[model samples]
Target: MDVKQVSVADKARRWIFSVHFCTPIIIIISPRLQILILAFLAASVSACKMNRCYNESELSEAVERKLRSHYHQPPDPLPAADPDSPSSCPVELYQYLAPHEENRRSLSPWRYVLRSMKDHFPSTYSEAECLCSGCILIQDVPGKGRVPVENFSYTSVPIIQSRVFLRRDLCGDGGKYRLTPVSQDVAVGCTCARPMST
Candidate 1:
């Protein structure tokens, strides 16, 4: 594209870049605009610090350690994190700000949007339960499973949903499998584990 073909979007980009080199324009702007700018800055800063929610390395290590302790043997040194795994879970900034939140009251409005999108799109997870024995991780039998739809008009359907909870495993025997059907409440999920791997 030639410079003569520059569109309004390009012009706006040029204007923004040119003004960014200037002094704090928010100071000269109206109070509402200044508050908006400050709120944005605060949100950005808060997002950068959201990793304090829970250290995955530490938490995963702890879970693994728990598994080892249950096995009645001193476990070896921690294994390296799966290098092929996806990036860590992204959480809102407010969840960790308070030491003891009652019922997810601190979440901002955007979290709802994120959650809705997550549900509507695609996801994979394993349900688990903590009984007197140990944590039981129950997952679907591996397949490219798809949802059966009665309505032909609806094109989008969920894929890979396990109808039976037959696969059961004690949490830390490196995916110890009992292969007995069961039910569970808590679901541990991520976009990383492959359909076959889980």
Candidate 2:
């Protein structure tokens, strides 16, 4: 078996020259000065590591924190209405806003579209319930015997939509998270309307 021996000076020279901070000036400088410069560079590299990017788990936790800060909760349910008697349309306030609003309400899209193609993104979420959960309509079908059938009826129509931005600085200094534009449906008020299809 052949053995290779490396001396302390050789090891020190290899380490010092291997560093990226080494330059032509390093050769002209004194050994003591070179050691000091290398030490400073080592300290700087370690300092940068202190601000290392967040890992998967840490990033998830950070995103959750941002979401919790801007969490939007639905309003309390309205009192139950009489089943047999016709009830007026019910609505409640619903809002989801960012820490700082961008006031880009006009950017919201009316119908479904690709979020990436949207020019304006949501920074604030402000919306309201336009209609009830579900509506059923009874219709009479022509047959030998008159038979009544129930069909799903009403739906909440969006009058306006606001493009809003989700959490920003998701990763911030350490890391970054992709921001996808979101469209929020906004209904100013409630109304009685028929489905275009049904």
Would you list the C-alpha lDDT of every candidate in the order shown? 0.28, 0.38
lDDT of 1 at 8: 57
Worst 10 residues of 1 by lDDT: 108-117
Encode model 2's per-residue lDDT on 1-198: one tens digit a residue. Answer: 222233454444322232234443222334578689999999999666433455545655654443455444333223322334343222111123242322211112111111232322233223433224333233455663433222336543445544333433344654544433244554433333466762
> How well does candidate 1 score on lDDT at residue 107?
17
- Displacement of residue 153 (Cα, Å) in model 1 is 15
Off by over 4 Å in 2: 1-57, 73-136, 144-175, 178-183, 186-192, 195-198
lDDT of 1 at 66: 33
| 1-198: candidate 1 lDDT, tens digit per residue | 112222353343221122334453321233466578899999999665422222334444433343344322222222222333333112223234354431122111111111111211012222211111111122243582332112222121112223222232333445332222333232222112122322
Candidate 2 deviation (Cα RMSD)? 17.9
Error of 1 at 125 (Å): 2.9
Best by lDDT: 2
